[model samples]
Target: MTATATEASPTDSYHGFLESLEEADEYAAIDTALGLIDAGVPAERVLLDLIAPAQVEVGERWARNEWSVAQEHAATHISERVVAAVAARAVPRPTRGRVVVACMDGEWHALPPRLVAEVLRLRGWQVTFLGASVPAAHLVSYLHRHDAHAVALACALPMRLPHAHRMIEACRRSDVPVVVGGRGFGHDGRWAHRLGVAWAPDAPAAADLVADERALRRVRPAELSQLADDEYASLAKRRGELIDGALADLRARAPGVREYTTAQLDSTVSDLGHIVDFLAAAVYVDDGSLFIDFVRWLIGILASRGVPASAVGLTLGYYVDELRDFPRAARFLGEASASAAAGTGPRAG
Candidate 1:
């Protein structure tokens, strides 16, 4: 009666499970998972095909504006509960070797790594999932006490590349090979390769790599040398000044903005700081496209929230003006804001 992913016949129930997730029925979601496991469905398939795909659908719904942020959070939270229920069924004391999985510091998207941990656990591997936002220092310290066959670190945001680089190097120093994945590392995981670490495109790939001892790569240095430049550091030091300057200038440029509520002001300030943080990461990695891509994505987010792209363009201009002495920073700002800087066209209010 064993139902491994390849042999699982409960596709009908899994769709019903997704419907429950969309409805935010936490009880039903848990029931769906428990019922599948009770029906002899393989635990691996439950994670690999069911919960994992549902989480992706949640994100897609949010991206397409079909689901509100609240709805996405509700669906994701339900998925987390479902994963725990499934993992609770994992056979106690797996004979396979130990593996440590963690999300990069400041990277809070932990579901993907959790899914991988459960899959590996079902496959008889001992998995210590460090959960979301693991500091590099804590991870290195953890490895000192724990002997892991491999350490997999997940980073969901490219903005966290700086932390990822440091964590990868720390793990390398411990002689424990690191497997890096998630959207943060780009489609081919080019950033992981550039930083001198093994790349896994998804949980399945990571599991396959973990199973293949030869695929566990040992990397040296694990560093992106361009980080030695002072531009990123200089920008970081001036981050507060940049935020204040942009907010002040924005107020002057758009006098009507003063009428915005306290919440709106806070949101505006937060978005401005993200611009700085993302720009610093781009500069640290020497990748202008990171800034450009983030800005394009952010423009959509702001437009969805009823904020004009031109408002973001104004903040970009402030960065360009404040960092006038820094040609690279100014150049990135201009390139990233090209579309926003132009009138929002017929799409904008």
Candidate 2:
């Protein structure tokens, strides 16, 4: 049996960490984080240098449009689970105070808030994580019930901003300091200032803002608006590059792998490729027609290959891999054409 390839150190760990993440080796990243902890890396260091970097890559893959919603979701869940596990065993410090972490209404992505909870929990703060999409009323009621020193809100899409603003106001009226993070928050940081809340770009930064009264006092929501916009644009651009590079890189890396590897690789690649497509649609669909027509053509060909209709859903699951073999995909279209001689599934109309 072949020995598994291994990276030399944690500094070099991120590249392989990203590959393992790409390959969807969830536990591998977890185990690496644990190893870093065991190696006497501080919990904050583990989070800031190791786990945070990993999450950044995962987020970038999503932003670059390299991963589909499902791929991004899977990676997010894995990273969260891994971080939670590591955090569970984390050495706790004295309580800074209790804080509630939640996703604002209409905001389904929770990884940002979860990360904030973990970061604070590790810092010895009493953290209550309410997960994603909590209703505005419930969040406000919970804040009243717990009287938390602070509340942190996460929203990934700009569409969620209106809901986030409502939640922020609800918390503020109750005299609770609200901290808003995630992609959408930065888009309108100035608006957050008007609401009298704090805005953080990511969890680690949130931790600082939450624990230091002076730091929290120093934060101006108006200043935050530009910060959020800057952070959002930066993350969006970086994520796009990472994903674009990853799609090209992973596709180029696939044919050399084994069949079992190929199947999995193909699936992941397709998912990432689809993610890119989805983001492109999200970002630019209003501007002009995109690749829906091309995708329809490809989907029709794959449908004819004895690859079941249900498997078509898996196409989005493996977007990067599918795009890698444009020639092969075309050849398969020819095979699919010949195979059309035999009755199969529905063809593209």
Candidate with best lDDT: 1
**Model 1 agreement with the true structure over 289-308: per-residue lDDT tens digits:** 77787887788877766777
lDDT of 1 at 78: 94
In model 2, the worst 10-residue window by lDDT is 281-290
Q: List where candidate 2 sits over 4 angstroms from the true fold.
A: 1-10, 62-66, 187-191, 214-349
190: Cα error in model 1, Å = 1.6
> Considering every candidate listed, which one attains the maximal TM-score?
1
lDDT of each: 0.82, 0.60
Candidate 2 structure quality by residue, lDDT tens digits, 236-307: 344456456665554455443234466666765564455444333222212111233333434444454434
Residue 5 miss distance in model 1 (angstroms): 9.3
Deviation of model 1 at 193, angstroms: 1.6
Candidate 2 RMSD computed on C-alpha atoms after optimal superposition onto the true structure: 15.0
- The list of candidate 1 runs beyond 4 A from truth reads 1-15, 218-223, 342-349
